[model samples]
Target: MAQDDTPSAFRLPDPAVVSRTMADVAERGQRIVQDFLKRQSDNASNGGGTGGAGSDPLNLAGAFMEMTTRLMSNPARLMQAQIGFWQDYMTLWQHTARRMMGKETGAVISEDPKDKRFKDDAWRDNEIFDFIKQSYLLSARYFQTAAASAEGLDEKSAQKVDFYTRQFVDALSPTNFALTNPEVLRRTAETGGENLLKGLSNLLGDLERGKGSLQISMVDRSKFSVGENIAVTPGSVVYQNELMQLVQYNPSTEKVLKRPLLILPPWINKFYILDLRPKNSFIRWAVEQGHTVFVCSWVNPDESLAEKGFDDYMQLGPYAALEAIEKATGEKNINAIGYCLGGTLLAATLAHMAAKRDTRIKSATFFTTMVDFEEAGELSVFIDEEQLQALEDKMNKRGFLEGSEMAGTFNMLRANDLIWSFVVNNYLLGQEPFPFDLLYWNSDSTRMPAKMHSFYLRRMYQQNDLIKPGAVDLLGVKLDLRKIKLPTYILSTREDHIAPWQSTYRATQIYGGPIRFVLAASGHIAGVANPPASGKYSHWVSDTAPPTAEAWLEGATELAGSWWPDWHRWVSALDKAQVPARTPGDGALAVIEPAPGSYVKVMASD
Candidate 1:
């Protein structure tokens, strides 16, 4: 509902099955039933098993009887639910009769106030429509309650059922139907059926582009370009390696912190999420705050880099950038920030540095990164043994995991906003996607190398290795979060599904440092990119570090403004004396091009 200039950092599936598979399954089932029947017939004909003619029919129907008994285990609960439903229906009927007798102005079946779909007057004004809407809503509520009340289901299985139930309920909304939706019908008449034709064309285009699947593009790509329009933060690409490019932003302040700020963004996405246009650019903001900013622009890895593992990223990404930043700024000590997966890598790199006694990293900042994957939210659902094997098989076929696959996973977390909303707007309404810079960045996805991705999932999500000391060996050392004692500032978004705030809060427990964890409002991208100038959303802050994330929330003070200023203050305290601004290529590292280097421009492989 609110405005966000930057897209979600998470910007962020196919079915093809021959009929032969289903036919085979059907034939197999048929054979089993036929064979069982034949066995019974043979036994009866020979009188080898039992005498059927003399036997009671109930004895022959034993299997059916057993199944029915098993199904009615909670007969009391079933009866109570039936009684409750009938009671509610009768009450509604009585209320409706009263309303019809001029005692009430509206229908007894009022839509749930919490229901966002039927907020329009049309749904409320017509008693018939209101009844239909309310009935569906009530039914949906009952279904969800039934799902929650289900026995013998694990938490994950119950959650999956609940999520699917929501999807089912969302799909059947009155707004999605043409005839039931007055607004859509009104638009249809106003357009003289033009909208329908355009919708068909749009649907066909999507199916064609998506290879028989519907992929609703969130932005009009034709209206925007990466460097020119969206990622327009003023900076120069000062350093490059096989894994990443370091961009040194042009300084806004005359003097800057002696300890230069180095950013490690997730290779899963382009680095421009931090530099999304000048107005909301975090990189631009850092430069203006008298800090020398260097961002890592990760390569859109292809098949050639499939074998590149997590260790490769550690050495080539942060380590390489650290060397380049030191050379460029002549600053021995550096302040570092890592975002999402980037933050996870930063934590590992920090631990590695601690083991080697490398003190170049003075202060560490993490933006929505998870060190412990114990409560990894919905993402854990995709990381089981079977799913991992399937993913590996898919990635093996194509050296790198496709960007769209990653995007789809994140989109599933918020299907209404990311998927169905687009479905209604782009396909049903036949409208061109909005020309949004954030959405454009979201659409411009990047690939992940197979080996690196596999290692990451297995180690972090599957094995739960990173947080455990001596569990994960990276760069010839056991990666331990407890070893790192650098001054740390960790931030997590309140509404982030990708890196849930509570999951991110685990870092405070793992990191053996003076860690300050702040919970910002909004989602993954918007939360981090929020500018104080906009004054859009409020953030929660506290000095106390509690054992549990919930306890932290209880003590945290709700502050009105962006967390950027708080971060600037925190980093300022740790920084050395201010020195004159240093330009890109002014020191050891030579300039390659402008900021947002060639790596970002490389489109996802077809």
Candidate 2:
């Protein structure tokens, strides 16, 4: 993993949550509300057709609706979405920490039997442990806020509140403090000086080898960048696109697959994750089973190309990528697979292009993509106007947003796993760190231009209008998911900490299309990297009519093996039959080199 000295932008201010301050503010606001209600009487009659704030039920209902309308319109509230995430994250972590430390669990760290990354130095590092602690502490403060809400009451009420409050604080204090604090540095036996380690004897060996995986800026490859090599199946032939972009090699069989498959990798991470490795890579299994595959490698954003925004991505990213696929393979449309933010972007692109009557994209495969914000989980707490303003203000100064900020925001989302875990393992435990591929890739983050970041936050998480028709405007055009009307495949892990599965499942409700929603086992990364080798890895597939996820869960029997093969089968069913292969571009669009394009090299961090 590339070494990053960058501190988190969402770093909690000193004295993370001020109990007295928050309590006082809550009381002051409450008092004002009380005064208003006390002074105002039920004088105005709603039946009189007066739109004023009357005391009638109808007027009260209208008032509530108005509040909802204003809340939606208010930029501050939208930004507050980000704030709420932290507040909630803190609370959940506090409770979960207690639960985790409690007895009901099997293994804190899941055992990945077939995962090779776990063999070398894959043990828990201080960083991961520290992240756990810090994340819990951060969540504990939110508990305080919630408890403070019911104040100035009797001794029992106060005692109940205080009991919970003190329990959380006490849980976190000396003992709890250790949970949140991830120590990254350690003392070396030889040097006798404090240094960083993670039980990574290999890292130490690599340090001795003098070729450790530290990324260096080369004038040849210098720009904000991050990179990782995922394990693709041995026999899989990964290829590049018209723009010289890296794509998994999906060879054509004499008998074309029943379901044509296309993997949609988020531009944020390298596309090879779909083809990560033989044991886990999804592409390898798909290709072996005679499925046609295409994956997109997003270009790393740079200052030179900061002008590109979400709309530009539609025109160039997935839109252009799909167009290239159709021309190259002579297929009218392909089954598209997307992961994380890429899924969100892919869904939006499909919507925007569909509105324009673009038919090249048929079925969509969304891996952990969400279109609704109503229950956006911990992510919403940070989506308030103030944060957006803070972020936008920063973006306005710079043409593009740094990958660090995006990575930071995401890391904060799972502070325990992403941020503090490394801190504790590396800093506190005095142990050498594990070098898991997914973790290594996770540490490799990419930056977004300010324009794109601001637009995404405002439009998607803030407005949440893209899921509906004519709700979002991309490149001066309206984006509607319904217009696409393509068969959509939405897959989210049951345990995904970043893009919650339930949130991703909402995609079915938003679009009136033939949708297949699958619940996979594992977190965001592990879910997509499903290979036949993972014995425990299973997915729920419902061949019957589309039903509620719960019903699908019940009716959809667990497959004996990996979800990747099942996805390929599902997609192959959607793809057109054998067609002439397209070499590259038609007309004056121009044919470029095979892919692994210039932009695609972008690692998530600089």
Candidate 3:
């Protein structure tokens, strides 16, 4: 075919459109700056300190300084690494040159197949973009390797250096920038710079919404509401207090499990993660399985609840809910399920109850919980003395740690998935985020009371005291995990960044009970929220609790579906007797509100 003189589709953007877009971006940029400055001024006037000494709250400087010193002491190794990086670049250059000559050449560096950033065809098919991608991958690998190879630093500092290094590398990925990203370029060509303009607008809107911080919209917040769509399980609030509301879901079966089921979700997030929709709602699924479910809907606490400690959470959370469940179900004996931080609290509560000779909890189930924080995983990077002190200073001023702050930390744990993907979509691509129920729930964060969060950080994360017999005291009772002899089901996710399966496995040895450890096949939320009907992920189960997590895994059986059914089987065996289904307000406790209740509906900003 004869080459036509028609301009290539990827030619220079329309000059007029480009000029208008830049002008609009400049105007929005000014607004963003002014808004940020105003927020800073307001915060300062309200006693929130100007970004000063505590700005490096993660103590990144100190960690990197130590790493730098160690690296500098080994000049030969550093030189060798630099030489290796240059060699890799040279090889990549040669590969690109060969490809330019229509010679097939293998990639010098390839990204993981699972990496979504470079999924666009142009990233690989277009030789120039492929070269750019390979160069970035090579550089990223070099930085990561160097960071990981850093010597002489403590384990915590080393981990901090490595984790932040990955963050830095991820941030600098070619895909993150519109100029380097092929898909964004294609979109720009198609839209005459409209995407870029819309992206700037979205960026400005997000900044405004976040009150100066860049809160990338993960989902279209307008698409969903608490009771209307997401957390729409059929239930009623049987009881409530200042800290929590006990939601007793209406049973779907004529005969339900004799022992009622109570779920204590992490107060760091809303309870509705387990009740996001009817299809995946664990509460709804449990109700369908002939078990009366009661969930502790924790209040999105603010300054008023700053004085509330871990003890208060236990009292108003599980303890209060237990009493309410007994009143509502006429059953003193009940099974309890705790998720993440809620599981941590439940473990402590069980120990406290064990100490007090209380046997109300006949069975216990922990979903990705950490009783022993020795190998607390990446989250430990944020719990050093300097960082915790800095965080406490901020919390002391505000009477509570801001929910977004906590949410940001969790987002960092999976920054590529939770943070940067949305950044690319909402800011770079100028596309509105899809209405994802999970992301919506993820965005609906909750605040942490000063005392409770502080105590949790110090005693559990920093000191790893929860496992120590008398290290942590709750309700005047020194917690001892071994004292809790209730039949336990420990469900840990294989890929849990928040609660490492290995870290959670430590509980098997800690608990003095008949322990059944099941490993689910996803991260924190998906693994636990997985319904049997979804058939999305597999699970592993081992009857024996070996001394080590590795040993347990070696002997485990890989099951084909959700661990919910496995959990049901285990929990059901504990108490096989069935009682007539009970309504929420039919017993001693009267209905306070609807299933999700008012507390969950309260936003952190509210």
Candidate 4:
């Protein structure tokens, strides 16, 4: 069969990502299911699915029957795997805790004992022996409950429910939960004991063989090699923009932007997620539309930068970016666009600059941004006192939060979808994971400075005071978002986990400026980076008065395509013009790479 000359009928370059993804799940799950079923088959090979005879013998038989049924159903072996894992995990946990106390400085390298975010810690500072105690208690409870319930019921029925319910209880035992929890009291509790003796010791007795672990795979690189359009010269809207090396990609266009543009992205992630490959970049589209866009690309922070708190970001990140734009364009105020954490930062900047009486940034646009922190949702589960203390202790020692720690927290929010989903596809399925460009990008992670994180959690999560007037103390300066009197546009996604949609809507009430609110289709990245013609995605109405998102969605109109193009229209009205396109930059960038920049190169990193 001749392959079509046009884009393949698959629509995507690779075979359908979704179908392969589903198959990966089914196939991968088959193994664990197979393993559990084997165990069940042992118990019930000759026995009936139902138990035989009276109380004593019948109870035993029914218990056997339930195990066989669970096995025969071919249910996943994750629980079994998770169970065995916890056993080994508890053993290691105890050993690690004991050895941790022997460290040179005695730092312990542990999480705050009070948080209880990870473990079944009924009290602060979990004791290692609690593992044994809790495990016994759990098993006892299961036995007691089952024995009692089975006493009054028909022998067979009682046995099955009791046996199955016991399995569920055993799965929830203390040893299981504690070991799997990421919030280990101490990092130094790592299982590795470095020495030739330790390695050789394990070699002799333990029956160990390497098994291919299940995990999600990375996406393939772009096959369609298309160069970017980045021509910088005069007769453009960004003409006479100042060129500054302190700032990146500075172009001296000989004129100030009558309509200046500013972009905001979250620090937890790299900036270029929005400025992704040229085909789907929001920044690239804005530049093509004759609007001047200034984007902030924050440098990943290291331990040395831990002392640099939220104030520095306000001053150097958005505030500095705005200043640079103003100096380059010679404009007093520029339009702002923020995505995710950057959106949160922008909202803060609006509040801060307004408090300082600096009104340089006007016409703000938020992409999936949130200002209200009252109901932070399930993600808040990891931020209680115990977890916070443990985090603080660890952060104090390291000075900066590890990227993996932050990534792990977000992963727990959707273990089935984000974490286990990948586990099923890549490692277990035995097939190279389908390479979707988006997942590849999502896998690319970043780091956060310790100080900034603490400030964010305290000011935003614990206080919920930033949205209220005069709450945050950024270098002793109070930030009130309501003071920022610029025209604002807030955007939120329907399926966002990080910044829930309704949280973004709360911005309407917080801001004193006139606002146009948009509800986009898809999750965080899909909603913002969404190009005009990806698939069937929809968004809610663009509202003005009575800024409630609910009331607006009900009364307001629906737009068929992207919030990007419509946003471009709404924003242009703030700084409208019929002028011709301007030069790309100050004619300084001799080699114009693509708009997405180097950050977006989605390689298959294991």
Which 10 consecutive positions of candidate 4 have the poorest summed lDDT?
Answer: 202-211
Clashing pairs in model 3?
none
Model 1 Cα lDDT, one tens digit per residue, 1-606: 864434221110011222443454455546555666786787557644544423432122333344335336766776676677677666666765665565764443455565556766767666656666766666666666655555655555555556656767777776777777665565666655445555656665565455434566888889988889888888899888888888898888888888899999998888888888788988888899999898999999999999999999999988988888878887788999999999999999999999999999999999999989988887876766656776786688679998887887888887767777677676566687899888888878899999999999999998889988999998789877899998999999999989899999988888888989899999999999898898898999999789999999999999998999999999999755899988888898888898778889998845
C-alpha lDDT (0 to 100) for residue 221 of candidate 3 = 94
Lowest summed lDDT over 10 consecutive residues: which window, candidate 3?
Answer: 3-12
TM-score of each: 0.85, 0.62, 0.96, 0.59
Candidate 2 — worst ten consecutive residues by lDDT sum?
Answer: 215-224
Steric collisions counted per model: 1, 93, 0, 35
lDDT of 3 by residue, 1-606 (tens): 854444335445578877877887788778878978887888889877747546777789989999999999998888889999999999999999999999999989889998998899998899999999999999999998887777899999999999999999999988899999988887877776778877888888888788778888899999999999888888898888999888889888999989999899999999999989889988888999999998988999989889999999998888888778878878899999999999998999999998989999999999999989989999999988888888888899889999899999999998888888988898888899999999999999999999999999998899998988998888899989999898999999999999999999999998888999999998999998999899899999888998999999999999898988888888998879998999888999888888789999999988
Which is the better candidate, 3 or 4, if ranked by TM-score? 3
Choose the strongest candidate by TM-score. Answer: 3
What's the lDDT of the predicted structure labeled candidate 4? 0.56
What lDDT is obtained when candidate 2 is compared to the true structure? 0.55
lDDT tens string, model 4, 418-532?
A: 6543332332222234555555545555667788888888778867778877767675678888787888888888888888877778888878888888888888778888888
* Better by lDDT, candidate 3 or 1: 3
Prediction 1 global C-alpha lDDT: 0.79
| Candidate 2 lDDT by residue in tens digits, 1-606 | 754434421222234234443554455445555654443433123233323322232122332344345445555744565588566566545545555575232222233365221222213333345335445445555455444444234433333344435344543432213223322211232222223222332223323222222221111122223322344332221334322253535353445553345666776566655654456666666666676666666666666666667777666667666665554555556667667877777788777776678776677788888777656665665566555775665566556676655666666555444544444444444444564656555555566777777777888787877766777777778777766588877777888867877777767777767877778887787776766776766777775444355655677777666676666667766643654322234322343434333445445544
User: Cα lDDT of model 3 overall?
Assistant: 0.89
Candidate 1, residue 5: lDDT: 34
